[model samples]
Target: MKIALIGAGEVALCLATEFCKSEDEVVVLTSTVKPSLKDLKAEIRLTDYSVENLKKNLDDCDAVVSTLSGPNEFYISAHSNILEACRQSRKCKHFIPSEWNINIEDFPDQPMFSAATHEVVRNKLRSQNDIKWTMICHGWFMEYLLPTKKNPLREIGLAWAMNHGTKVFDMYADGLQKVTLTSTADAARAVLAVLRDSINTGADLPPVTHLAGQTLTYRDLFQLIRTRDPAWKSNPVTFVEVLTAIHEGLKANDALVAIHQMRIMGFTNANHNPKGKALEWGTGILQGLRATSVEEFLDQSEAGEDK
Candidate 1:
Protein backbone atom coordinates (compact mmCIF):
# COMPACT_ATOMS: atom_id res chain seq x y z
CA MET A 1 0.00 0.00 0.00
CA LYS A 2 1.18 3.52 -0.80
CA ILE A 3 0.64 6.26 1.81
CA ALA A 4 0.97 10.06 1.59
CA LEU A 5 1.81 11.90 4.80
CA ILE A 6 1.07 15.62 4.75
CA GLY A 7 3.26 17.93 6.83
CA ALA A 8 6.70 17.17 8.27
CA GLY A 9 6.16 17.95 11.91
CA GLU A 10 6.78 15.58 14.80
CA VAL A 11 3.60 13.58 14.19
CA ALA A 12 4.24 13.21 10.48
CA LEU A 13 7.88 12.27 11.03
CA CYS A 14 6.93 9.60 13.55
CA LEU A 15 4.21 8.24 11.25
CA ALA A 16 6.52 8.26 8.24
CA THR A 17 9.29 6.51 10.16
CA GLU A 18 6.90 3.81 11.35
CA PHE A 19 5.14 3.37 8.00
CA CYS A 20 8.47 2.98 6.19
CA LYS A 21 9.28 -0.02 8.39
CA SER A 22 6.66 -1.97 6.41
CA GLU A 23 6.85 -2.87 2.71
CA ASP A 24 4.36 -0.09 1.99
CA GLU A 25 5.62 2.97 0.13
CA VAL A 26 5.61 6.17 2.24
CA VAL A 27 5.63 9.65 0.71
CA VAL A 28 6.00 12.77 2.84
CA LEU A 29 4.51 15.97 1.43
CA THR A 30 5.71 19.15 3.01
CA SER A 31 6.54 22.75 2.17
CA THR A 32 10.01 22.43 3.69
CA VAL A 33 12.02 19.30 4.37
CA LYS A 34 13.56 19.59 7.81
CA PRO A 35 16.91 17.99 8.74
CA SER A 36 15.08 15.36 10.80
CA LEU A 37 13.10 14.23 7.75
CA LYS A 38 16.32 13.62 5.81
CA ASP A 39 17.04 10.51 7.91
CA LEU A 40 13.73 8.81 7.18
CA LYS A 41 13.59 6.11 4.52
CA ALA A 42 10.78 7.65 2.52
CA GLU A 43 10.26 9.78 -0.59
CA ILE A 44 9.97 13.46 0.25
CA ARG A 45 8.18 16.04 -1.92
CA LEU A 46 8.36 19.74 -1.23
CA THR A 47 5.31 21.61 -2.48
CA ASP A 48 2.82 24.22 -1.38
CA TYR A 49 -0.66 23.01 -0.36
CA SER A 50 -2.43 24.51 -3.35
CA VAL A 51 -5.18 22.26 -4.67
CA GLU A 52 -3.41 21.65 -7.96
CA ASN A 53 -0.12 20.93 -6.26
CA LEU A 54 -1.74 18.54 -3.78
CA LYS A 55 -3.74 16.79 -6.50
CA LYS A 56 -0.62 16.20 -8.57
CA ASN A 57 1.34 14.92 -5.57
CA LEU A 58 -1.46 12.76 -4.22
CA ASP A 59 -1.71 10.86 -7.49
CA ASP A 60 -1.64 7.07 -7.10
CA CYS A 61 -1.55 7.26 -3.30
CA ASP A 62 -3.72 4.73 -1.47
CA ALA A 63 -4.28 6.95 1.55
CA VAL A 64 -3.37 10.42 2.88
CA VAL A 65 -2.63 11.21 6.51
CA SER A 66 -2.36 14.84 7.60
CA THR A 67 -0.25 15.98 10.56
CA LEU A 68 -0.33 19.63 9.59
CA SER A 69 -0.14 22.21 12.37
CA GLY A 70 -0.41 25.99 12.23
CA PRO A 71 -2.74 28.84 13.04
CA ASN A 72 -6.48 28.13 12.91
CA GLU A 73 -7.01 29.72 9.49
CA PHE A 74 -3.92 28.07 8.10
CA TYR A 75 -5.06 24.66 9.29
CA ILE A 76 -8.51 25.06 7.80
CA SER A 77 -7.19 26.30 4.45
CA ALA A 78 -4.52 23.64 4.06
CA HIS A 79 -6.88 20.83 5.03
CA SER A 80 -9.48 22.17 2.64
CA ASN A 81 -6.96 22.01 -0.15
CA ILE A 82 -5.91 18.49 0.83
CA LEU A 83 -9.50 17.30 0.92
CA GLU A 84 -10.12 18.73 -2.50
CA ALA A 85 -6.96 17.18 -3.83
CA CYS A 86 -8.08 13.79 -2.58
CA ARG A 87 -11.36 14.23 -4.39
CA GLN A 88 -9.65 15.34 -7.56
CA SER A 89 -7.09 12.52 -7.44
CA ARG A 90 -9.93 9.96 -7.35
CA LYS A 91 -7.56 7.22 -6.12
CA CYS A 92 -6.89 8.24 -2.52
CA LYS A 93 -9.93 7.00 -0.65
CA HIS A 94 -8.77 7.03 2.93
CA PHE A 95 -7.90 10.23 4.82
CA ILE A 96 -6.87 10.83 8.42
CA PRO A 97 -7.13 14.44 9.48
CA SER A 98 -4.70 16.16 11.84
CA GLU A 99 -6.79 15.77 14.94
CA TRP A 100 -4.28 14.15 17.27
CA ASN A 101 -5.79 15.69 20.37
CA ILE A 102 -8.85 15.40 22.59
CA ASN A 103 -12.19 14.14 21.23
CA ILE A 104 -13.61 17.26 19.56
CA GLU A 105 -17.06 15.72 19.28
CA ASP A 106 -17.71 16.24 22.98
CA PHE A 107 -16.67 19.89 23.06
CA PRO A 108 -17.18 21.45 19.67
CA ASP A 109 -15.86 25.03 19.35
CA GLN A 110 -14.96 25.12 23.02
CA PRO A 111 -11.76 25.30 25.08
CA MET A 112 -9.69 26.11 21.99
CA PHE A 113 -10.37 28.24 18.93
CA SER A 114 -8.79 25.57 16.73
CA ALA A 115 -11.61 23.24 17.62
CA ALA A 116 -13.91 25.39 15.51
CA THR A 117 -11.55 25.04 12.57
CA HIS A 118 -11.63 21.28 13.01
CA GLU A 119 -15.41 21.39 13.01
CA VAL A 120 -15.31 23.14 9.64
CA VAL A 121 -13.05 20.42 8.24
CA ARG A 122 -15.32 17.71 9.63
CA ASN A 123 -18.33 19.26 8.01
CA LYS A 124 -16.54 19.30 4.67
CA LEU A 125 -15.62 15.62 5.12
CA ARG A 126 -19.18 14.76 6.00
CA SER A 127 -20.58 16.52 2.96
CA GLN A 128 -18.68 14.10 0.76
CA ASN A 129 -18.82 10.29 0.90
CA ASP A 130 -16.06 9.40 -1.57
CA ILE A 131 -13.28 9.67 1.00
CA LYS A 132 -13.31 7.41 4.03
CA TRP A 133 -12.02 9.47 6.95
CA THR A 134 -11.31 9.05 10.66
CA MET A 135 -9.92 11.33 13.37
CA ILE A 136 -7.53 10.00 16.02
CA CYS A 137 -7.92 11.50 19.49
CA HIS A 138 -5.06 10.46 21.79
CA GLY A 139 -5.31 13.34 24.24
CA TRP A 140 -2.00 15.01 25.14
CA PHE A 141 1.40 13.91 23.89
CA MET A 142 3.23 12.37 26.88
CA GLU A 143 6.66 13.51 25.71
CA TYR A 144 5.87 17.06 26.84
CA LEU A 145 6.57 15.87 30.37
CA LEU A 146 10.25 15.51 29.46
CA PRO A 147 12.79 18.00 28.19
CA THR A 148 13.79 18.24 24.52
CA LYS A 149 17.07 16.37 25.08
CA LYS A 150 15.28 13.43 26.62
CA ASN A 151 12.72 12.85 23.84
CA PRO A 152 12.69 12.70 20.04
CA LEU A 153 9.55 14.87 19.73
CA ARG A 154 9.95 18.46 18.58
CA GLU A 155 9.30 21.10 21.20
CA ILE A 156 5.80 22.53 21.08
CA GLY A 157 6.10 25.95 22.71
CA LEU A 158 4.87 26.38 26.27
CA ALA A 159 4.76 22.97 27.87
CA TRP A 160 1.29 21.93 28.95
CA ALA A 161 0.41 21.66 32.68
CA MET A 162 4.04 21.26 33.75
CA ASN A 163 7.51 22.64 33.02
CA HIS A 164 10.31 20.17 33.60
CA GLY A 165 13.05 22.79 33.31
CA THR A 166 11.53 25.10 35.90
CA LYS A 167 10.35 22.15 38.03
CA VAL A 168 7.06 24.03 38.36
CA PHE A 169 3.61 22.48 37.77
CA ASP A 170 -0.04 23.50 37.75
CA MET A 171 -2.68 21.51 39.58
CA TYR A 172 -6.23 22.09 38.36
CA ALA A 173 -9.05 21.80 40.89
CA ASP A 174 -7.25 19.50 43.32
CA GLY A 175 -5.61 17.61 40.41
CA LEU A 176 -7.79 14.52 40.71
CA GLN A 177 -9.43 14.56 37.31
CA LYS A 178 -8.19 11.89 34.94
CA VAL A 179 -6.44 12.62 31.61
CA THR A 180 -5.05 10.26 28.96
CA LEU A 181 -1.46 10.48 27.78
CA THR A 182 0.03 8.76 24.70
CA SER A 183 3.60 8.89 23.54
CA THR A 184 4.22 9.95 19.92
CA ALA A 185 5.86 6.62 19.11
CA ASP A 186 2.85 4.74 20.42
CA ALA A 187 0.47 7.07 18.62
CA ALA A 188 2.22 6.46 15.33
CA ARG A 189 2.00 2.73 15.89
CA ALA A 190 -1.68 2.90 16.68
CA VAL A 191 -2.38 4.91 13.52
CA LEU A 192 -0.41 2.42 11.43
CA ALA A 193 -2.42 -0.42 12.99
CA VAL A 194 -5.66 1.32 12.14
CA LEU A 195 -4.58 1.85 8.55
CA ARG A 196 -3.45 -1.77 8.21
CA ASP A 197 -6.71 -3.06 9.64
CA SER A 198 -8.74 -0.92 7.28
CA ILE A 199 -6.77 -2.20 4.30
CA ASN A 200 -6.93 -5.84 5.42
CA THR A 201 -10.59 -6.07 6.38
CA GLY A 202 -12.00 -3.66 3.76
CA ALA A 203 -13.81 -1.87 6.59
CA ASP A 204 -14.33 1.83 7.11
CA LEU A 205 -12.39 3.41 9.93
CA PRO A 206 -14.35 4.59 12.92
CA PRO A 207 -15.15 8.30 12.97
CA VAL A 208 -13.08 8.71 16.13
CA THR A 209 -10.49 6.28 17.51
CA HIS A 210 -9.00 6.80 20.96
CA LEU A 211 -5.49 5.70 21.97
CA ALA A 212 -4.06 5.97 25.48
CA GLY A 213 -0.69 4.88 26.78
CA GLN A 214 -1.82 5.61 30.31
CA THR A 215 -4.42 7.61 32.22
CA LEU A 216 -3.75 9.40 35.48
CA THR A 217 -4.73 12.50 37.39
CA TYR A 218 -2.64 15.63 37.72
CA ARG A 219 -1.77 14.70 41.30
CA ASP A 220 -0.59 11.30 40.10
CA LEU A 221 1.59 12.96 37.50
CA PHE A 222 3.04 15.31 40.15
CA GLN A 223 3.85 12.29 42.30
CA LEU A 224 5.62 10.64 39.40
CA ILE A 225 7.66 13.79 38.76
CA ARG A 226 8.44 14.06 42.46
CA THR A 227 9.54 10.45 42.45
CA ARG A 228 12.09 11.48 39.84
CA ASP A 229 12.98 14.77 41.59
CA PRO A 230 11.73 15.48 45.09
CA ALA A 231 12.29 19.17 44.51
CA TRP A 232 9.46 19.45 41.94
CA LYS A 233 6.65 21.76 43.08
CA SER A 234 2.98 22.27 42.25
CA ASN A 235 0.88 25.48 42.19
CA PRO A 236 -2.76 24.60 42.65
CA VAL A 237 -5.35 26.47 40.54
CA THR A 238 -8.99 26.14 41.44
CA PHE A 239 -11.73 25.46 38.88
CA VAL A 240 -12.97 29.03 39.17
CA GLU A 241 -9.47 30.37 38.77
CA VAL A 242 -8.87 28.41 35.56
CA LEU A 243 -12.20 29.50 34.17
CA THR A 244 -11.46 33.10 34.97
CA ALA A 245 -8.02 32.86 33.39
CA ILE A 246 -9.46 31.34 30.25
CA HIS A 247 -12.01 34.13 30.01
CA GLU A 248 -9.45 36.86 30.57
CA GLY A 249 -6.91 35.21 28.30
CA LEU A 250 -9.38 34.93 25.48
CA LYS A 251 -10.38 38.54 25.87
CA ALA A 252 -6.72 39.64 25.78
CA ASN A 253 -5.85 37.29 22.88
CA ASP A 254 -3.35 35.63 25.13
CA ALA A 255 -1.48 32.72 23.56
CA LEU A 256 -1.66 30.79 26.79
CA VAL A 257 -5.45 30.62 26.78
CA ALA A 258 -5.36 27.25 25.03
CA ILE A 259 -3.20 25.81 27.77
CA HIS A 260 -5.51 27.20 30.39
CA GLN A 261 -8.50 25.57 28.69
CA MET A 262 -6.66 22.27 28.45
CA ARG A 263 -6.14 22.36 32.22
CA ILE A 264 -9.84 22.81 32.67
CA MET A 265 -10.54 19.95 30.35
CA GLY A 266 -8.18 17.72 32.28
CA PHE A 267 -9.69 18.80 35.57
CA THR A 268 -13.19 17.87 34.39
CA ASN A 269 -12.18 14.44 33.06
CA ALA A 270 -12.82 15.67 29.51
CA ASN A 271 -9.54 14.14 28.38
CA HIS A 272 -10.37 10.61 29.55
CA ASN A 273 -11.88 7.70 27.68
CA PRO A 274 -14.27 6.10 30.17
CA LYS A 275 -15.74 3.65 27.61
CA GLY A 276 -12.47 1.69 27.11
CA LYS A 277 -12.67 2.34 23.37
CA ALA A 278 -8.91 2.51 23.05
CA LEU A 279 -8.46 -0.78 24.92
CA GLU A 280 -11.01 -2.61 22.79
CA TRP A 281 -9.58 -1.10 19.62
CA GLY A 282 -6.08 -2.05 20.69
CA THR A 283 -6.84 -5.68 21.54
CA GLY A 284 -9.44 -6.36 18.86
CA ILE A 285 -8.17 -4.47 15.84
CA LEU A 286 -4.72 -3.22 16.81
CA GLN A 287 -3.76 -6.82 17.73
CA GLY A 288 -1.95 -6.34 21.04
CA LEU A 289 0.32 -3.40 20.22
CA ARG A 290 1.19 -2.35 23.75
CA ALA A 291 1.62 1.37 24.37
CA THR A 292 4.48 2.73 26.47
CA SER A 293 3.36 3.67 29.93
CA VAL A 294 4.23 6.94 31.71
CA GLU A 295 6.45 5.09 34.17
CA GLU A 296 8.36 3.39 31.34
CA PHE A 297 8.81 6.71 29.54
CA LEU A 298 10.24 8.33 32.67
CA ASP A 299 12.61 5.40 33.09
CA GLN A 300 13.70 5.78 29.47
CA SER A 301 14.25 9.49 30.00
CA GLU A 302 16.34 8.76 33.08
CA ALA A 303 18.41 6.24 31.14
CA GLY A 304 18.94 8.74 28.34
CA GLU A 305 20.08 11.33 30.86
CA ASP A 306 22.54 8.86 32.44
CA LYS A 307 24.08 8.10 29.07
Candidate 2:
Protein backbone atom coordinates (compact mmCIF):
# COMPACT_ATOMS: atom_id res chain seq x y z
CA MET A 1 0.00 0.00 0.00
CA LYS A 2 1.17 3.52 -0.75
CA ILE A 3 0.86 6.14 2.00
CA ALA A 4 1.43 9.77 1.12
CA LEU A 5 2.49 11.64 4.25
CA ILE A 6 2.12 15.41 4.16
CA GLY A 7 4.78 17.28 6.13
CA ALA A 8 8.43 16.30 6.68
CA GLY A 9 8.94 17.68 10.16
CA GLU A 10 9.69 15.51 13.19
CA VAL A 11 6.11 14.36 13.77
CA ALA A 12 5.67 13.65 10.08
CA LEU A 13 9.05 11.91 10.06
CA CYS A 14 7.93 9.73 12.97
CA LEU A 15 4.75 8.77 11.12
CA ALA A 16 6.61 8.19 7.87
CA THR A 17 9.23 6.01 9.55
CA GLU A 18 6.57 3.94 11.30
CA PHE A 19 4.56 3.56 8.11
CA CYS A 20 7.67 2.53 6.13
CA LYS A 21 8.47 -0.23 8.64
CA SER A 22 5.19 -1.88 7.64
CA GLU A 23 6.62 -2.59 4.17
CA ASP A 24 4.33 0.02 2.64
CA GLU A 25 5.46 2.77 0.31
CA VAL A 26 5.83 6.16 2.10
CA VAL A 27 6.01 9.42 0.23
CA VAL A 28 6.55 12.74 2.03
CA LEU A 29 4.65 15.77 0.75
CA THR A 30 6.11 19.04 1.95
CA SER A 31 7.22 22.43 0.68
CA THR A 32 9.92 22.95 3.27
CA VAL A 33 13.22 21.06 3.35
CA LYS A 34 14.11 19.24 6.55
CA PRO A 35 17.81 19.09 7.37
CA SER A 36 17.02 16.61 10.13
CA LEU A 37 15.95 13.96 7.62
CA LYS A 38 19.09 14.37 5.52
CA ASP A 39 20.52 11.02 6.60
CA LEU A 40 17.25 9.17 6.01
CA LYS A 41 16.69 7.93 2.49
CA ALA A 42 13.04 8.09 1.38
CA GLU A 43 10.83 9.43 -1.38
CA ILE A 44 9.84 13.07 -0.79
CA ARG A 45 7.71 15.23 -3.06
CA LEU A 46 7.30 18.92 -2.39
CA THR A 47 4.01 20.82 -2.76
CA ASP A 48 3.33 24.45 -3.56
CA TYR A 49 -0.36 24.09 -2.77
CA SER A 50 -1.24 24.22 -6.46
CA VAL A 51 -4.37 22.16 -7.01
CA GLU A 52 -2.96 20.50 -10.09
CA ASN A 53 0.35 19.69 -8.40
CA LEU A 54 -1.26 18.15 -5.30
CA LYS A 55 -3.79 16.14 -7.34
CA LYS A 56 -1.02 14.86 -9.63
CA ASN A 57 1.17 13.75 -6.70
CA LEU A 58 -1.60 12.34 -4.51
CA ASP A 59 -3.07 10.28 -7.35
CA ASP A 60 -2.99 6.49 -6.83
CA CYS A 61 -1.97 6.74 -3.15
CA ASP A 62 -3.79 4.52 -0.69
CA ALA A 63 -3.72 6.93 2.25
CA VAL A 64 -2.75 10.49 3.11
CA VAL A 65 -1.74 11.70 6.57
CA SER A 66 -1.11 15.42 6.98
CA THR A 67 1.21 16.51 9.83
CA LEU A 68 1.82 20.08 8.79
CA SER A 69 1.96 22.78 11.50
CA GLY A 70 3.60 26.13 11.99
CA PRO A 71 2.65 29.75 12.29
CA ASN A 72 -1.09 30.40 12.29
CA GLU A 73 -0.61 32.78 9.40
CA PHE A 74 -0.62 30.10 6.68
CA TYR A 75 -1.76 26.99 8.52
CA ILE A 76 -5.40 27.04 7.42
CA SER A 77 -4.51 27.73 3.82
CA ALA A 78 -1.91 24.98 3.68
CA HIS A 79 -4.12 22.38 5.35
CA SER A 80 -7.02 23.38 3.12
CA ASN A 81 -4.83 22.54 0.15
CA ILE A 82 -4.00 19.12 1.62
CA LEU A 83 -7.68 18.40 2.28
CA GLU A 84 -8.51 19.40 -1.28
CA ALA A 85 -5.70 17.22 -2.59
CA CYS A 86 -6.99 14.21 -0.70
CA ARG A 87 -10.54 14.92 -1.87
CA GLN A 88 -9.44 15.04 -5.46
CA SER A 89 -7.22 11.98 -5.28
CA ARG A 90 -8.40 9.06 -7.41
CA LYS A 91 -7.10 6.16 -5.30
CA CYS A 92 -6.59 7.59 -1.83
CA LYS A 93 -9.62 6.85 0.31
CA HIS A 94 -8.26 7.29 3.82
CA PHE A 95 -7.12 10.71 5.02
CA ILE A 96 -6.13 11.77 8.52
CA PRO A 97 -6.11 15.47 9.15
CA SER A 98 -3.70 17.16 11.59
CA GLU A 99 -6.09 16.86 14.49
CA TRP A 100 -3.49 15.58 16.96
CA ASN A 101 -5.19 17.15 19.94
CA ILE A 102 -7.48 16.18 22.78
CA ASN A 103 -11.10 15.31 22.05
CA ILE A 104 -12.38 17.99 24.44
CA GLU A 105 -10.98 20.75 22.23
CA ASP A 106 -12.55 19.31 19.06
CA PHE A 107 -15.81 21.19 19.57
CA PRO A 108 -16.75 23.86 17.10
CA ASP A 109 -17.68 26.24 19.88
CA GLN A 110 -14.09 26.37 21.12
CA PRO A 111 -12.78 29.93 20.72
CA MET A 112 -9.28 28.75 19.88
CA PHE A 113 -8.10 29.50 16.34
CA SER A 114 -6.69 26.03 15.80
CA ALA A 115 -9.89 24.50 17.09
CA ALA A 116 -11.94 26.68 14.78
CA THR A 117 -9.83 25.69 11.77
CA HIS A 118 -10.24 21.99 12.62
CA GLU A 119 -13.98 22.38 12.99
CA VAL A 120 -14.16 24.15 9.67
CA VAL A 121 -12.25 21.42 7.89
CA ARG A 122 -14.20 18.73 9.67
CA ASN A 123 -17.49 20.26 8.55
CA LYS A 124 -16.26 20.44 4.97
CA LEU A 125 -15.24 16.77 5.05
CA ARG A 126 -18.62 15.79 6.43
CA SER A 127 -20.43 17.08 3.35
CA GLN A 128 -18.49 14.71 1.12
CA ASN A 129 -19.01 10.99 0.48
CA ASP A 130 -16.19 10.53 -2.01
CA ILE A 131 -13.33 10.14 0.45
CA LYS A 132 -13.06 8.80 4.00
CA TRP A 133 -11.35 10.90 6.70
CA THR A 134 -10.56 10.31 10.35
CA MET A 135 -9.10 12.59 13.00
CA ILE A 136 -6.43 11.62 15.58
CA CYS A 137 -7.39 13.48 18.75
CA HIS A 138 -4.68 12.23 21.06
CA GLY A 139 -4.90 14.97 23.65
CA TRP A 140 -1.72 17.00 23.86
CA PHE A 141 1.62 15.98 22.41
CA MET A 142 3.43 14.25 25.30
CA GLU A 143 6.73 15.26 23.74
CA TYR A 144 6.24 18.81 25.01
CA LEU A 145 6.65 17.55 28.56
CA LEU A 146 9.58 15.28 27.73
CA PRO A 147 13.09 16.74 27.67
CA THR A 148 14.91 16.35 24.37
CA LYS A 149 18.61 15.59 23.97
CA LYS A 150 19.69 18.41 21.68
CA ASN A 151 17.70 21.02 23.56
CA PRO A 152 16.21 20.95 27.03
CA LEU A 153 12.92 22.40 25.81
CA ARG A 154 13.36 22.19 22.06
CA GLU A 155 9.62 22.01 21.44
CA ILE A 156 8.84 24.72 23.96
CA GLY A 157 8.44 27.11 21.09
CA LEU A 158 5.43 25.15 19.88
CA ALA A 159 3.78 24.52 23.26
CA TRP A 160 1.97 27.12 25.38
CA ALA A 161 1.13 25.09 28.47
CA MET A 162 4.40 25.69 30.29
CA ASN A 163 6.87 28.55 30.31
CA HIS A 164 9.87 26.10 30.11
CA GLY A 165 12.52 27.93 32.12
CA THR A 166 10.19 29.17 34.82
CA LYS A 167 10.71 27.38 38.08
CA VAL A 168 7.10 27.82 39.20
CA PHE A 169 3.94 26.34 37.64
CA ASP A 170 0.46 27.58 38.57
CA MET A 171 -2.11 24.92 37.77
CA TYR A 172 -5.84 25.35 38.18
CA ALA A 173 -7.98 23.41 40.64
CA ASP A 174 -6.19 20.82 42.80
CA GLY A 175 -3.83 19.87 40.02
CA LEU A 176 -4.80 16.23 40.56
CA GLN A 177 -6.89 16.26 37.42
CA LYS A 178 -5.84 13.99 34.56
CA VAL A 179 -5.93 14.83 30.86
CA THR A 180 -5.37 12.80 27.71
CA LEU A 181 -1.91 12.77 26.19
CA THR A 182 -0.04 10.60 23.64
CA SER A 183 3.49 10.41 22.37
CA THR A 184 4.16 10.99 18.68
CA ALA A 185 5.28 7.40 18.31
CA ASP A 186 2.26 6.14 20.18
CA ALA A 187 -0.07 8.24 18.07
CA ALA A 188 1.65 6.94 14.96
CA ARG A 189 1.01 3.44 16.19
CA ALA A 190 -2.67 4.25 16.65
CA VAL A 191 -2.77 5.75 13.17
CA LEU A 192 -1.21 2.57 11.81
CA ALA A 193 -3.84 0.57 13.65
CA VAL A 194 -6.54 2.70 12.06
CA LEU A 195 -5.03 2.05 8.66
CA ARG A 196 -4.93 -1.73 9.15
CA ASP A 197 -8.40 -1.84 10.64
CA SER A 198 -9.83 0.39 7.94
CA ILE A 199 -8.41 -1.85 5.21
CA ASN A 200 -9.32 -5.20 6.78
CA THR A 201 -12.68 -4.33 8.31
CA GLY A 202 -13.78 -1.82 5.70
CA ALA A 203 -15.17 0.25 8.53
CA ASP A 204 -15.76 3.96 8.31
CA LEU A 205 -13.34 5.78 10.57
CA PRO A 206 -15.05 7.78 13.29
CA PRO A 207 -15.35 11.55 13.01
CA VAL A 208 -13.11 11.93 16.07
CA THR A 209 -10.70 9.58 17.89
CA HIS A 210 -8.81 9.98 21.17
CA LEU A 211 -5.79 8.28 22.74
CA ALA A 212 -4.13 8.83 26.10
CA GLY A 213 -0.76 7.17 26.66
CA GLN A 214 -1.22 7.29 30.42
CA THR A 215 -3.61 9.56 32.26
CA LEU A 216 -2.07 11.42 35.18
CA THR A 217 -2.79 14.63 37.06
CA TYR A 218 -0.95 17.93 36.84
CA ARG A 219 0.61 17.19 40.23
CA ASP A 220 1.83 13.84 38.96
CA LEU A 221 3.29 15.48 35.90
CA PHE A 222 5.01 18.23 37.88
CA GLN A 223 6.24 15.82 40.54
CA LEU A 224 7.65 13.58 37.84
CA ILE A 225 9.37 16.52 36.22
CA ARG A 226 10.77 17.66 39.56
CA THR A 227 11.91 14.12 40.29
CA ARG A 228 14.01 14.25 37.15
CA ASP A 229 15.36 17.81 37.60
CA PRO A 230 14.53 18.54 41.29
CA ALA A 231 14.41 22.30 40.90
CA TRP A 232 11.00 22.93 39.42
CA LYS A 233 8.11 23.97 41.70
CA SER A 234 4.36 23.86 41.04
CA ASN A 235 1.34 25.29 42.84
CA PRO A 236 -2.40 25.12 42.42
CA VAL A 237 -4.52 28.04 41.22
CA THR A 238 -8.23 28.70 41.60
CA PHE A 239 -10.56 27.97 38.70
CA VAL A 240 -12.28 31.27 39.45
CA GLU A 241 -9.15 33.05 38.32
CA VAL A 242 -9.23 31.29 34.95
CA LEU A 243 -12.97 31.71 34.60
CA THR A 244 -12.62 35.38 35.24
CA ALA A 245 -9.95 35.69 32.60
CA ILE A 246 -11.94 33.72 30.05
CA HIS A 247 -15.04 35.79 30.72
CA GLU A 248 -13.16 39.07 30.57
CA GLY A 249 -11.21 38.08 27.46
CA LEU A 250 -14.22 36.87 25.58
CA LYS A 251 -16.16 39.96 26.59
CA ALA A 252 -13.29 42.04 25.28
CA ASN A 253 -13.19 40.03 22.02
CA ASP A 254 -9.67 38.84 22.82
CA ALA A 255 -10.13 35.31 21.63
CA LEU A 256 -6.43 34.65 21.10
CA VAL A 257 -5.54 35.54 24.64
CA ALA A 258 -8.65 33.89 26.00
CA ILE A 259 -8.22 30.68 24.01
CA HIS A 260 -4.51 30.21 24.68
CA GLN A 261 -4.99 30.85 28.35
CA MET A 262 -7.90 28.44 28.39
CA ARG A 263 -5.56 25.62 27.38
CA ILE A 264 -3.61 25.43 30.62
CA MET A 265 -6.69 26.39 32.55
CA GLY A 266 -8.71 23.57 31.02
CA PHE A 267 -5.92 21.06 31.42
CA THR A 268 -5.58 21.96 35.04
CA ASN A 269 -9.31 22.26 35.50
CA ALA A 270 -11.00 18.98 36.37
CA ASN A 271 -14.39 20.26 35.24
CA HIS A 272 -13.51 19.58 31.59
CA ASN A 273 -12.42 16.04 32.32
CA PRO A 274 -14.69 12.90 32.09
CA LYS A 275 -16.81 14.49 29.37
CA GLY A 276 -14.59 13.82 26.35
CA LYS A 277 -15.61 11.30 23.67
CA ALA A 278 -12.32 9.44 23.97
CA LEU A 279 -11.63 6.43 21.77
CA GLU A 280 -10.53 3.31 23.52
CA TRP A 281 -8.13 1.04 21.64
CA GLY A 282 -8.44 -2.43 23.09
CA THR A 283 -5.39 -4.42 24.10
CA GLY A 284 -3.06 -5.73 21.37
CA ILE A 285 -4.00 -2.94 19.02
CA LEU A 286 -0.87 -0.84 19.48
CA GLN A 287 1.33 -3.96 19.33
CA GLY A 288 5.08 -3.41 19.85
CA LEU A 289 5.67 0.07 21.29
CA ARG A 290 3.08 0.40 24.01
CA ALA A 291 1.87 3.80 25.21
CA THR A 292 4.43 5.02 27.75
CA SER A 293 3.98 6.66 31.13
CA VAL A 294 5.38 10.04 32.13
CA GLU A 295 8.21 8.36 34.02
CA GLU A 296 9.13 6.06 31.16
CA PHE A 297 8.92 8.90 28.63
CA LEU A 298 11.37 10.95 30.69
CA ASP A 299 13.73 8.00 31.06
CA GLN A 300 13.73 7.46 27.32
CA SER A 301 14.29 11.12 26.54
CA GLU A 302 17.13 11.50 29.06
CA ALA A 303 18.70 8.20 28.00
CA GLY A 304 18.77 9.38 24.42
CA GLU A 305 20.57 12.56 25.50
CA ASP A 306 23.29 10.52 27.21
CA LYS A 307 23.87 8.55 24.03
Q: TM-score winner among the candidates?
A: 1
Q: Which stretches of candidate 2 lie over 4 Å from their true place?
A: 70-77, 105-108, 148-163, 238-259, 262-289
lDDT of 2 at 128: 85
| Per-residue lDDT of model 2, residues 1-307, tens digit only | 7778887776777667667676677788888777755654557787886767888888978888887765564666766676677778887778887766555443445435456666667777888877778877666667777434333223543123444566565564667666556677777777878776776677887776667776766767777777777777765666666567667877888745545454553554322223245445455444554677767877887788789
* Residue-level lDDT tens digits of model 1 in 1-307: 7899999877777778888887888899989869988888899998799999999999889889999977888898999998889889968878999988875556555456577778888899888887888988887788888876765676644336777677788787778877788888788777777877787678987788888778888899889888878989998777788779889998999988876766667566667755556645447776877888898988887887789
lDDT (0 to 1) per candidate: 0.80, 0.66
Per-prediction TM-score? 0.91, 0.81
What RMSD does model 2 have? 3.7
Superposed on all Cα atoms, model 1 deviates from the true structure by an RMSD in Å of 2.1
- Per model, how many backbone clashes are there? 0, 1
**By summed lDDT, which 10 consecutive residues of candidate 2 come out lowest?**
151-160
Off by over 4 Å in 1: 154-159, 279-282
Cα misplacement distance, residue 171 of candidate 1 (Å) = 1.0
